[model samples]
Target: MTEIPAVENAITIRDLVVDYGTRRILDGINLDIPAGQIMVIMGGSGAGKSTLLRCILGLKKPTSGSINILGTEVNGVRARDMHALRKQMGVAFQGGALFSSMSVAENIQLPLREHTRLDETTIEIMTRIKLDMVNMLPHEHLMPAELSGGMTKRTALARAIIMDPKLLFFDEPSSGLDPSTSAELDELIIMLKNSMRMTIIVITHELDSVFKIADHIAVIGEGRILETGTPEQIRASTNLEVQDLLHRKARETVVDADAHLRRLVGEEE
Candidate 1:
């Protein structure tokens, strides 16, 4: 018998809680995301998925517990140190959040300019490289408003990876796209994971996306994690909430006239 190598975790959250006034948005979240793996946070609407992402990004302070990312405590870090810590992450917002005023190339170059002392020519080369990575090199001169929804999303992804951060966070990567387009995005995500070897945490509810790309998933409900497992594990889970959630989308309709009639007659009686 051979012992398996121990995997290193990129993120660790223990007893995490977040409160907005009296409302508890996240309650005692405990999660571990292994290094260089694509982990997904999934749930229905208002399930605190985004809150958990924000907490991990250090945008929101935890009321209790700890969030350790790349061996640094997120909540307790100093402001200057926190800024440095944040540089290790790349985030893609839900709406593609690109600057309407800037060309795709300019938008991608923004982070490089801010963070690096590289000359203009070097930044241009780096920007083009990232755009090429996302297959948006041809659209470099186009502005956000000039691109299609899918292209805009790809451009946002290009900008996200321009700095080559250690961690990548995506908010609803497949939102507002047709099934085929969504699937395309899924393929792109898979390619990014393999090529970049960076830890990825995506907040999404798209089942197709989840099944396609998630190495592990944390299902959130009522501001807490209901379960965390691989797609196969989640599909075979006995937890009713998990079952209902995973199956509801695929449930078929069956006529039950006799049952309906019985209930109606019982009510009359």
Candidate 2:
């Protein structure tokens, strides 16, 4: 019999916890995001999805447990080392989060300028390369305020990849967009994973996007990870929380006669 090879993990979190005042936002999250794959974190509002990402990025301190990225322990890592760790990550926030005052090229060049000793000409070339990667080469001169929502998101993506970071984080990539635009972003995300070989962690509640792009999913509910698996595994999971989330149906409901009649008749026909 042949044995299958184990996959390498890029980000690992064990027994992670985050508390704000008296409330615990993330009770205990244990997740292993595989290298070079896109992992989607899904949950309802206030489920601590964003909190987990912040902790991993070292923006928030974890109350307990451990987080390791690219084989380095994040907790108590020195300031200089943490800065280096941060350079390995690029984040696209819920909004485009681009600088309104800077043109697209300038925004994308910010990381390169701050992190690298590359010459101005080299930085300019790299900026163009990143913009091209996100299919925003023609909009390099546009300000964030001037671009449409989808264009803004793509420009933000260009900035995120400007440094060629090993890991990328996206917060609510499809939020506040029409369905078609959101779908296009999903395709772009898939392209990034396939072409760049970067590890990606996306915090999202959009089910369509999740199914379309997630190589694996971690489902959080009430401050804990309820389940983690591939999309098919998640769909077939018998876990009550996972089932409720995937179906988006309340446990029980009493409908009015007219609505119930319409639903039943429509189903029968």
Ten consecutive residues with minimal summed lDDT in candidate 2?
A: 248-257
Q: Identify the leading candidate in terms of lDDT.
A: 2
Residue-level lDDT tens digits of model 1 in 169-235? 9899988888888898888888888988889988888888999999999999888889999989988
Clashes of each: 0, 0
Q: Candidate 2: where are CA atoms >4 Å away?
A: 249-269
Model 1: CA > 4 A from native: 251-269
Native-to-model Cα distance after best TM-score fit, residue 118 in candidate 2, in Å:
1.2
Score candidate 1 by lDDT.
0.88
What tens-digit string does per-residue lDDT give for candidate 2 at 1-269?
Answer: 89998989999999998889999999988999999999999998888898898899999999998999999999999999999999989999888888899999999999999899999999999999888877799989988888988888888888888888899998888887888889988998898899888999999988889999999999999899999999999989999888988777232223477766788889634
Pairs that clash in candidate 2: none
